[model samples]
Target: MSIQDIVFVTGNANKLKEVKMILSSESSKFNLINEPLDLEEIQDVDLKSIAMAKCKQASEILGPNRPVFVEDTALVFDEFNGLPGAYIKWFVKSMGLAKIVQMLDSFDNKDAKAITTIVYADGKGEFHVFQGITEGTIVSSRGPTTFGWDSIFQPKESTNGQTYAEMAKEDKNLISQRGRAFAQLKTFLAAESM
Candidate 1:
């Protein structure tokens, strides 16, 4: 697919902004369509399934020519057997990050990670899936610069045990789950354009 023929479908403005910034920095030649293709949120599901479902929904709305991209991310904690893996959104909205931290306070393991899967479909049965993961541990307090659960999640071997929110934008973009997934997408698009 050509760069001018791509569109990103999402409802989160923050995520859109971050994606735009990343693409811009790479001089990525693609258009971003901010239209929100509605998808019902299914509880207690796997990340890949959620991504595929969203991709299908967006493709149906976009018709048979235009391509649409959708992503679903989940925070999986090793200590809790990946509790809230696919339910991170509801958990965050219902309990907030603070309460989640409190809930994990007594767990024997703090190892956690974020898994992001992006699905791009051309509405013609042609689709691609890209995934990114950031290995980290759960922190007790929120960081000043991070958004969402950023302040409460620290990457492994991080300096001062800081989370993505505590790291600079450049640094975060280098190792973030979204960053990794987008990088893979960028590479795929670049190759396809060749």
Candidate 2:
């Protein structure tokens, strides 16, 4: 089935927009839908499990006819031993990015990576999970054009010492965790359709 043939489920408008843009660039014939799922917070310790919980919730809400997709992502720092792995949202809400960077400053290790796990369910209890990862380091200062942790998080081996946020949207999309996951999803969808 083409993207146009599938109904995309999402509660976040920003994420929905980004996903739609990525899908459209790959195939204009695909359809994008923004259906919010009644998802609940999971008390799980692993990001993958949390993502599956969200997907299961969405699948239940969507019934048996529609397929729902849910994604959970985390930022793991080498020094912190993955302190914020599955609690990234909590960390963001409690300490914010600047404080997190300040806390990281005390450590000599700045190596980090962003991992995203995407769960897709067809409302029949059957699901698929896809993971995408991007390795990088945390920078000390913020950049002019980046948002969120974009200004402070620099990907490893990046040219000009730029963060994901500093790169153009197209460029970032090519290397981002979401990008990698979506690429895999596209391939899956294509194969399934055939």
Which candidate should be chosen as best, given lDDT against the real structure?
Answer: 1
| RMSD versus native structure for model 2 | 2.3
The Cα error of candidate 2 at residue 164, in Å, is: 1.4
Best by TM-score: 1
Candidate 1 per-residue lDDT, tens place, 1-194, comes to: 44566668888887888888766744556666777766876555578878887778777777757877887888998877877787877788888888888877887788898988999885457989999999998887657723578788898846677787788777887888888899998888777657
Q: Each candidate: how many clashes?
A: 2, 5
Write down the lDDT that model 1 would get. 0.79
The lowest-lDDT stretch of 10 consecutive residues in candidate 2 is 1-10
Q: Which whole-number lDDT from 0 to 100 does residue 169 have in model 2?
A: 72
Q: Please identify model 2 stretches exceeding 4 Å from their true place.
A: 1-5, 26-29, 144-147
TM-scores of all candidate predictions against the true structure: 0.91, 0.88
